[model samples]
Target: MPTDTRARMVTGAARMISRRGVDAMSLRELAEQEGVPLGSTYHHFPGGKAELVDAAVNHVGDRVAESIAGTRGQGTEHIVRWVLHAWRRILIKSDFRAGCPVLAAAVAKDERHRDTARAVFGRWTDGLIDVLIEDGVPPVRAPSVARTIIASLEGAVGLARAFGQIGPLDDVEAELIRLVAAAAGEPAPGAGR
Candidate 1:
């Protein structure tokens, strides 16, 4: 719904990549999907498909990091639930057709795409680690706990998409809350609710 053609193209490319991945997403299809002329894609992304893919990856990555950062004082359980609910909504809204754009890029054959994913994942993990530390999780354990949460959620998203259900995400969310609670030395909120 972005009025700017370039922004629309980037958002559309992210959605396309979520479903079809990097190698399978063609610029021409992206143009048609975004209702932009093929030449405009070149104008906006002079580096061609690689440039567009990078932009799309960064777009999704920034959005996700910002979302996580927004939950600074909401407590660990709320943060975990919020993140899982966001993914669950995406799965249901897209009819299980879409997964994470960054994950899609990470699995691509292109080294550049993988590198972008690595940086994005690092940023997300760092943000979560900071939030965990804020919630009283030991600094020593926050990093590993953050990484585990992200890795498990990413895998759960893929499983949810593949199985056409959100059960995988739900299961991961429950376990993640317990993992985080244990790390924070606090009782798990709504434990086994």
Candidate 2:
């Protein structure tokens, strides 16, 4: 099954824009990277740069939601592990120099882009919240807990990247495991120290 050229171009552009800020992108540059002709780019997105950016933002959001949906219905531990592995893959794919795609777009001024970013992040939080609620957290608290975990993980990634070491991520991972365990009233491994 062959994918339509526009969809392929959008997918490639979304990956590139996620790894490199939108401000640094151009249609010509995207065409070159995608190996698609300039005429085809305009044929697919006649509105040009703004339209391309919009498509890219939505494309990335859908990609993220699809990834999270695949990991649904296991357990909180599984979700946590999936998140860690996903973050590691993103970090490596971007050469450890880029912030998260949704996070970057959140700080960007374009309202539509930010909305797309928020939608993507909301899906991730909601997915994790479902796992947390299943693990016995109060339904009302699950979303907040999920958000805290996400914020902490992002912060840990930033710190680790800034220091050029993975210690921050490792510490955050261990602490996340411990926090989730304690929330479930499971005995922490090395308690009573």
TM-score of each: 0.92, 0.81
Off by over 4 Å in 1: 1-3, 186-193
Residue 35, candidate 2: alpha-carbon lDDT: 84
CA lDDT, every model vs. true structure: 0.90, 0.73
**Predicted candidate 1 versus true structure: per-residue lDDT over 60-156, tens digit per residue:** 9999899888988886678778878898889999999988899999999999999999999999999999999988888888888999999999999
Candidate with the greatest TM-score versus the true structure: 1
Please report the TM-score between candidate 1 and the true structure: 0.92
Best by lDDT: 1
TM value for model 2: 0.81
Candidate 1 has which clashing residue pairs, if any? none
Model 1 has an lDDT value of: 0.90
Q: What pairs collide in candidate 2?
A: none
lDDT of 2 by residue, 61-121 (tens): 6766676667666667776676677767766666776556666667666787778778877
